[model samples]
Target: MALNYDEIVGKFDKYIFNTYTRQPVAIKKACGAVVTDVNGKEYIDCVAGIAVNNVGHCHPAVVEAIKRQAEQLIHVSNLYYTEQQALLAEQLVNLTEMDRVFFCNSGAEAVEGALKLARKATGKKEFIAAEHAFHGRTRGALSVTHKEKYRKPFEPLAPAVFVPYDDADAIREAITEDTAGVILEAIQGEAGVIIPSDGYMKEVREICDETGTLLIVDEVQTGFGRTGKWFAREHSGIKPDIMTLAKAMGGGFPMGAMLAREDVAANFGRGDHASTFGGNALSCAAALANIEVIKKEKLVARSNEFGAYLMKKLKNLNKDYVKEIRGKGLMVGMELSIKCEDIVGKARERGVLLNCTSDSTLRFVPPLSITKEQLDRTVEVLDGI
Candidate 1:
C-alpha cells in the first residue's frame, strides 16, 4: 500500500491538534543526516528531529538494543525493578555529577519534576529564571519560561521572576529569601541559540551558593554530545544542583529525566513522584545504547570540530542578510536582518532542510554523525541562496 502525502496532510488537518505549523514535506525515513520524504526526495537533515536524533536516525546499535529489549520486556512499569532501568540510571549518574535520576516522558516533564524537587527541597515558593530562556510548556515549566507569548494565554502561572540573561548583577538583585531555585538554559536554544558571556555561569554559580538557591540547568536540547561537551554546563566548569535532560537521551524513544544532587533528590520520599511509563525497559535500553554510541564513537569531539568548520564556512559567505552567526558546537544559528521563513522554504526546495527559530534566526542542529562533506554540500546550497 503506497502512502499518500496529501491524504495524510488532509487527515492531520481534520484530526490532529492545531499546535504546529508543519513543513510541507512528510518524512518517510531517515539515515545519518539525510531524510527521505514520502515522495522519495532526500534532504540533508539539519533539524535532526529538533536535536532528538543526536546519534542519527535509526542508529544500528540503538535499533538493535531497542529490538532486543522490546522482545524481552518493553514495559513493566516503575513499580517493579528492571535491570535496564537501573543500569540506565547508573550510566546517567556516571556521566554526570548528579547523584540520582528521576525519569519522565519529555523535557517538559523533566522540568516539571525539577521544579517540584526544588520547591520541596528548599521549601521556598518563588523561582528566578532568565529572560529568553525556554524550559518547557507544562504549567511549572511554562511559569519559568521567559517568553511572554507562550506564557500569556495561560495566565496566573507558578510564581517566578525573570532577569536578563547573562546579567550577574540582575541575578544577584533578583535572588531573595523566597527564591527556591534559579533555572536557566546553559545556551538558550529556542531563543536563537544565545550563548552567555564568559564567567556568566560561574558568577551565577557563586550567587546560588551564597543565597542558598538551587541552580537548575536545562540541558534538554544541548545534551548527548549535541554540544562539544557531554553537557553544556561542563563548558563553564560548574555543576548545577539539578539538571533536566531529554531530547537525545533515548535515541528516538521518548524519554526525559531530572538529575539531582543526593540531598536535593532525597527531598522526594516514597510515592512522592512516579510516571507510569517513565523508565520503561525499552526506553532505558535505548538510552543506554545511545550513550554507548556517543561515548564509543567520540561524537563530542566531532561536534566541536565539524561545528567550527560549518561556522567558518557560513561566516565566509558574508551574506548581506546575515546579522550574526552564534552558537556552540553543532547548535549554530545564523541571525538574519530579514524574516527567514522564506529562506527556509527556499532551502527546502534546494534539498537542504533548515529550521527557523525566534522568527529571524536560522537554526542548524545537524546530527553529530553528519559528515564534513555533507556539511560542505549544505554550505554550498546556502551559498547559492
Candidate 2:
C-alpha cells in the first residue's frame, strides 16, 4: 500500500524524538504559499515554514542554485575557502553593513556565536535580555531566553538577567559592570510580535554607549524582510555591536549567521569559533539565490505593502475575542482573549495553516511573495472560523 499520513506519523511516534508538538497533517510537497498533504489536502501555508520560506517554497532560483552547487561543491571545511562562501559572506557583509560574518546551521547556533563573541569582546560573562524573549534552545541561548518553563528544565544555564521589553529604564537598571552585552529581539517573535516603542532601541543603543556595553540584536525571526525591512533594526536606525540572523536567509534552506562591526568583531581571533558545515557551498548558494530573489522581486516592499493590507483586513474581522492585532511587514499576530491553540487546529482543518504562539497569539508569517488574493482568502478562512 502507498504511504499515508498515519503510517508516517506512526513511524515518527516510534523513532523520532518526542520534542515538538506537531500538527496532524503530513506534508508531501510545498510551493509558493501552499502545501499539499499526504491525503491530497491542500492548504494555504500561512506559517511559511515558520517564516523560513520568504521567497516561497521550492523557488526555482533557489532550487536551481542548490542543484548547481551540489553538482560542483556541496561541503568544504572552514580550513579552506570556497568561492560560494566568499561570495555569500561578501554579500551578507554588504547587505547588513557589518564588517564580518560567522556562519552557522541554525538560529540557535547564531545566538550562541553572538553570545560567545560578546563575551570575548567585552571580557564579561553576563547578558541582559528582555522578558518573554526567545533567542534559541541551546544552553547559552536558553540562558537568555525568558520563558520559565523552557528554562526550568535547563536550569543552571549561563548568567543572564531578564527585564521588561521596550523598557530602556529596566535594562539600564539591570546592567552592571559584569554585563557582557544586552541581547534583544528587534521584534519579539516568540513573544507574539512585541514590537518595541519608537526610540526604545535607540535609547538602548545610547545606554550601551554610555556604559561601554555591547548590544546584540537577534533578528533570527524578523530579518530578510519579515518586518518590511531587510532587518527590523533598520526601522530604529541604530546598529548593534552584534546581530544574529537566520530563518529566511536561505530561501527555505537551513542557514544562520552572526554579524558584527569590524572593531567589535576583531576581538575573536581565528580558530576561536568554527562550524564544520557552516557556510558550506550548497547552503551559501541557496542563500545567495534567496537574497537575489528578494532584491529582484522587491519582496521587502511587498512585505511592507501586504503586511499593512493583512493587518487592516484582520482589524475589521467581526470577532469579539480579538484583543489586538499587531506586526510589521508580513509578521502579523492576533492576540485573542482566549487561548489560540483551538483556533489553530480549526484553521488547519479549513485549509489555512496558522501558528499559535505565546498560547494566546496567532502568528502569521506567510511568505513575502504571497498574493493579495491569497491574503484575502486567508482572512476569509479566519473569519469563517
Candidate 3:
C-alpha cells in the first residue's frame, strides 16, 4: 500500500513533540546512494542520514545479518552473556586498538559512559572541552557541547572549561589540576567540518599525558570510514585514551560504545554503570556485519579517493557565495559567506539531498559506497543552485 505523505506529516505535526522542524518531504525508501520520497521523487542522497549509512542503505550482508539475528534472538538483557555481544565487543576493541568496550544505545550515552570513566579514573570533577565541540544532547554531554544556545536552557551544567580549538596554548591554559578529562571531536561535525591545525592532535595527546588528563576523542560523526580512515584520529597518528563511537558503527541500528584502555576501564566495577538494552544481540549482529562489509569492500580507501574528487568538484563552485571547502574524506563541508538554507532547499528541489550546519555551512556526508557519477550529479545540482 502507498503511504499518504501529506496526511502522515500533518498527523505527525499534531501528535509528535515539536523538537525538530522537519523537511516537508517524506522519505519512504532508500537503496545504495538514492532515496525515493513518498511522492515518487527520487534524489541522490548525499546526506546518507548524516553519515549513518556508511555501507549504503540496506547492504545485502547487513540486511541478511539483521534477518538472521532476528530469527535467532532479537535481544538478551545485559545480565546474561550472548555470543553476538561478546563478539562485537572483541571486534570493536581490536579495531579501536583499545582494551575494553562498553556498549550503549546512542552517541550521547557513549559520551556519558566515557565521562564517567574519565572522572572515576582521574578522581577529578572538572573537564576541558574544545570550543564549538558537540559531544551529545544529554545533560552531561550537553555540559561540554560549547554552544551557548543549546546550553542556555539547562544551566548549572557539569564543570567543564572550554578552550579554543586548534590552539594548543589555549588547551594548555584550560587543563587545571582538577580537570578529569579533555574531550573533543577529532573533526568538528556540527561546527561545519573544521579540521584541527597541523600537529594539533599530537600536542593534545602530549598535553593530556602531562596533565594526567584522559584524552577522549568523540568519533560519533568521523568514525566508521566517514573520514576516510578507520578513525579520524589515525590520520593524526595519535591514539586517544578513550573514544566514543556511534552513527555508522551499527549500520543504521541504534548502538553506541566507548573504547578505552585497560587501566582506564578499571575504574568501572560491576554495578557501577549498566544499560538495560546495551549490547543486545541484534545490534551486535548489525555492527559486526557492518564492519565486515566495510572491510570486504575497502570502503575506507574509497572514501579517501572519492572524497578528494568531491572536494575538487566543490572547489569549482567557489563563486560569490562559497567561502571555503574543507573536510577529510567523505565528510566534506562548504562554508558560505551567506546563509545556505535556501541553497539547500533549492538543491533538494532539484533531486539532490544535503544538510546545513551552523546555518551558513553546508555538510556533505555521502555514503561510503557513493559512486563518482552520483557525486557528479550532486555537484551539478549544487552548481545550479
Candidate 4:
C-alpha cells in the first residue's frame, strides 16, 4: 500500500517543532541530482541538502561503506579507539596543513569545539567575527554569528565583536588583548554565497599573525570539494590556524570535525571535550568513501568546469529580475532586486528545486556529479520563470 502523504504531514504538524517553513513536496527517494516526491514527481535538486551531498545522494560507494561498516560495528563511543576514526583523522591531517583533529557530530559542534579551543589556547575572553557571517546555532557559535534576527531572540550571547567582512583593516581594529581569535567563513554560504574580495583572506592571516590571534576558518558548507578545492581557503592561499568541517564529510551521515595546529590543539586535555557518538565506525567509514569518490571521480575539477558553464549560461539569460550572479564552483547564487521566494516556488513547480537565502538571493549548490545536460535543463526552466 502507498504511504499516506496527508496523514504524514498531519503527524509532522502535530508532533514536530515548527522550525522550518518546509517546501510543499515530500521527497521519498533521490539519486545523483534528482529527487522523487511521494507522488512520483521528479525534480533536479540544486540544493544538494544545502551542500551536504557533495558526492551526490545515495552514492554507491558511500552506501556500501555504510552497510559494510554497520554489519561489523557502528558505535563504540569515545571510550575506545577505532581504526576507522584514526584513519579518517589521518586522511584529514594529510589533506591539510593541520596537525590534529577533533571529531564531532554536526557543524555546530565543530564550531563549538573550535571556539572552546580558541579560548583555551589564547586564554582570552573575547572573539572577533565577521558581519553577515553565520557560524552555527549553538550558544558559542551563535555568539559569533552576525544576523540580528537569529541572534536577537537569544540575547546576551557569549562575548564577541563583529567586524565588516572582507575588510582586513576592520579585523585589525577589532582585535585586542582580550580577543582570543577571529572566525569567518571563507565563502559565506548562508549570506547568499558571498565571496570575499581578492587577497582578503591572506590579509586576515597576516593580521592574525601580527596580533597573536588564532585564525579560524569555517568550511562547513564550502569544504569537501564543494568549492572546486579541498577547502575554499586554498583559493586564497592561506592556511588558518584552525578549520571547522562538516556537511558532506560523512556522505549523508552525520559527522563533523575541527582540525587545529599541533601547539594550539594541545590546549585540550584528555577530559576537556568529547562526544559519545563522534568518530563512530559507521560515520568514519562513510567519510572515507566520500573522500575517495571525490578523488577517484576527479569531481573537484568537474565542479570548476561545470560551474563556469553554469555561470556563463545564467549570465546569457540576462533576465531583468537578476541583479547579479556570483559564486565559486557549484556554489552559485543569483541575487535579485526583488524578493526571490516566489521565484523559488515557481521554479519548484517547473521541476527544479532552488533555495532562496537572505530573501532576495537564489542559491544553487548542485551535486558535484551533476551533468551538463542536467544543468542545461535547469537553465531552461529558469528562463521560463
Candidate 5:
C-alpha cells in the first residue's frame, strides 16, 4: 500500500527543520503556470516558485537537458572540468559584462562569496546596504539584510550600515573610507517589488566609482530574464563590479553564480574559495538549456509585453485598497492601504496564486513564458477578489 498525502506531510512536520512556516497545501505536480496539490486541487501559480521558474514549470527544454545529462554524468568535484560547466560559464559571461564566474549552490552562498571577494579585494570590512533589503539568510548575507525582526535575534551581524533606498544623499552619508562595498538589489523583491527612483542605480554607480568601493548587485531574484532584460541592471545602463545570481539560473535545480571582473576574481587564487557541488555537470546542463530557451523563445520580450498588460489590468481594478502599483518588466508589486494577506488568501481560493511582501505589498513574479490569455484569467480572479 502507498502512503497517503496527510501521512507524508505529518512525517515532514516531524522530521524537517523547523525554519520555514510553509503553506498548508501539499503541491504534488506542476506544469506551465499551474500547480496541483496532493489532494488534486489545481492553482494558477503567479508566484512562479518565488521567481525561480521564469521559463515556466517543467519546461521541455530544461527537462530534456536534465534527462540527457543524467545519463551522461551527474556529479563531479571541482578537481575535474566538464564541458557543461564550461559552456554554462561562457553563456553567463557573454550574457553579462562581468569578466569571470564563480558557481555555488544557492543565492545565499553567492552572496557570501561576493561579500568575501569584495572585502578581500578592497582590504576593508564595513559595507553599506539599503533599508528593507534582503540579500539572503546566511550569516554574512543576513548581516547586510536590514530587517530588525530577522536580525535582532542574530546579533553581531557583519559590520554594515543601512541607508534609505533610492536616496542618493543618504547613501553618500553612509559611505566612508572603511566601507568595502555597497550591496543592493536592483529591485527589492522581498520588500514588495520596491523599485528605486530613476537614475538611482546610475547615481550609486557614480558614487562607488568616486569612493573606490566595489558595487555588488544581488540579482538572485531579478536575474535570468525576470525583468524582461537579461538583467535588471541592463535597464539602468549601469555596470556593477560584482553581480550575484541564482534563483532561475538552474530552472529548478539548485545553482548560483557570482560574476566578477578578472582582476577581482583573482583574489580567490586556487583554494581560497570552493564549493564541493558547484557547477556540477547536471546543474550546468540544466542551466545551459534554461538560457537557451530564454534566448530562443524570446520569453524576455514576452514578459515585458504581458507584464505591461497585467499591470494595466490591475491598475484598472483601481480598488480603494490599492495604494500604489510599482515594478519593471515582469517583476511587479501592489501596495495596499490595508494588510495584503487577506487578499492573497482570497486570490488563492479563487485559483489565482500570489503572495504578500512585508505586510502591505502584493508581489507578482510570474513565469516569463506565461501567456496573455492566462494573465487575463488571473485578472478575472483579481477583479472578483
Candidate 6:
C-alpha cells in the first residue's frame, strides 16, 4: 500500500511532540542526492539530511554492511567486545589522529560525552563556549550552547562561559581556574555556518595550552569530509584535546563518538561513562563501511572541488540582498539581508530542498557526491526565486 502523506501527518499531530518546525513535504525515499516525497515529487537535496548523508543517501555499501551485520550480531552489551567495534575505533583514530574514542548515539550524546570527559579529565566544572555556538540540547551540552530561547526555560545548566566566537582575546579573558575546557565548532552550523578566521583555531589552541585548559572541537556537523578535509581541524593544523563526531559518521545510521588524546581519554576509566548502545556491532559495522565508502569514492577531494563550483555559481547570482557567502568546502552558507525562511519554501516549490539557518542564512550542505548538473539546477532554482 502506498503511504498517505495526510495520514502520516495526522498521526504525527496526534501522537508526536510539538517540538520541531518541520518542512511540509513528507519524504518517502531517498537515493544519492535526491529525496522523493510521498507524492513522488523529487527534490535535489541541498540539505543532505542537514549535512548527515555525506556519502550520499542510502549508499549501497553502507546498507549492505548493516544488513550483513544485523544478520549476525546486531548488538551486545559493552561489557564484551566486538570486532566491528575494534575496527571502527582504529579507523576513527587513524582519520583524526585522536588516541581514543567513546561511542554514543547522536550528536547531542557525543557532546554530552565530550563535556563529561572534559570535566572529568580536567577536574574542573566550568566550560568556555563561543557565543552563537550550537553544541547540543542535552543539559550538559546546553550549558555550553549559546542561545537565549533554548537556554531560558532550561536555566541553571552546568557551569559555562560564553565568549565571542573566533575571538581568541575574548576566550583568554573568559578562561579562569575553574574552566575545564573550551568547546567550539570549527564551522558554526546553527549560527549560520560562521567560519572563523584562518588563525582563530590555532590561536585558541595556543591559549588553551598556555592556560592548561582542554580544547574540545565539536565536529558533529563538520566532520566526515563535510568541510573538504577528512576533518575541519585539518584546515587549521591544530590538534584539540577532545573532539565530538556524529551526523555523517554512520552514513545516516544513528551513531556518535567522543574522541580524545590518550592522556585525556585515560581519565574516563571503567564506570566513568558509558552508552548502552554505543559501539554496538550494528552501528560499528555501518560506520566502518561508511568510512570505507568515503575513502573509495575520494569524496573528500570531491567536496573541495565541487564546493568551489557551487560557490562560484552562487556568486554569479548578483543579488543586492545577498549579505555574504562563506564556508569551507561543502559546508557553505549564504547570509541574506532578509530572513530566508520564505526562500527555503520557494526553493522547495521549485524542486530543490534548502534549509535556512539562524533565520537569515541559506545553508548549502549538499552530499559530496552531488553532481555538478544537480548543483547547477539548485542554483538556477535560487536564481528564479
Compute the lDDT for candidate 1: 0.94
Candidate 6 has an lDDT of: 0.95
lDDT of 4 by residue, 91-119 (tens): 99998779999999999999999999999
Give one digit per residue, the lDDT tens place, for model 6 in 1-385. Answer: 7659998899899999999999999999999999999999999999999899999999999999999999999989799989999999999999999999999999999999998998898899999999999988999999999999999999999999999998999999999999999999988999999989999999999999999999999999999999999999999999999999999999999999999999999999899998999999999999999999999999999999999999999999989999999888899999999999999999999999999999999999999999999999999999999
Checking candidate 4 for backbone clashes, the offending pairs are none
Query: Candidate 3: worst 10 consecutive residues by lDDT?
Result: 1-10
Q: What is the lDDT of candidate 2?
A: 0.95
User: Please, what are the lDDT tens digits per residue for candidate 1 over residues 1-385?
Assistant: 8668999899999999999989999989999999999999999999999999988999999999999998999998877999998999999998888899999999999999999999999899999999988998999999999888899999999999999998989999998889999999999999999999989999999999998999999999999888799999999999999999999999889999999999899999998888999999999999999999999989999899989999999999998889999978899999999999998898999999999999999999999999998999899998888
* Local accuracy of candidate 3 as per-residue lDDT tens digits, 163-257: 88899888888878899999989999999999998799999999988878899999999999999999999989999999999999888888999
Superior by TM-score: candidate 2 or candidate 5: 2
Count backbone clashes in candidate 4. Answer: 0
Model 4 alpha-carbon drift over 4 Å, by segment: none
TM-score of each: 0.99, 0.99, 0.99, 0.99, 0.98, 0.99
TM for candidate 5 is 0.98
Question: Model 5: how far is 57 from its true place, Å?
Answer: 0.3
Tens digit of per-residue lDDT, candidate 2, span 1-385:
7788889999999999999999999999998999999988999999998989999999999999999989988997788889999999999998888899999999999999999999999999999999999999999999999999999988999999999999999999999989999999999999998999999999999999999999999999999999999999999999999999999999988999999999999998988999999999999999999999999999999999999999999999958999999999999999999999998999999999999999999999999999999999999989988
Clashes of 6: 0
> Model 6 residue 38 lDDT?
95
Model 2 backbone overlap count: 0
lDDT of 5 by residue, 200-311 (tens): 9999999899888899999999998888888999989998999999999999888999989888888878877899999999999999999999999998898888778889
TM-score of 2: 0.99
Per-residue error for 39 in candidate 6, Å, reads 0.8
Mark the regions of model 1 whose C-alpha exceeds 4 Å error after superposition: none
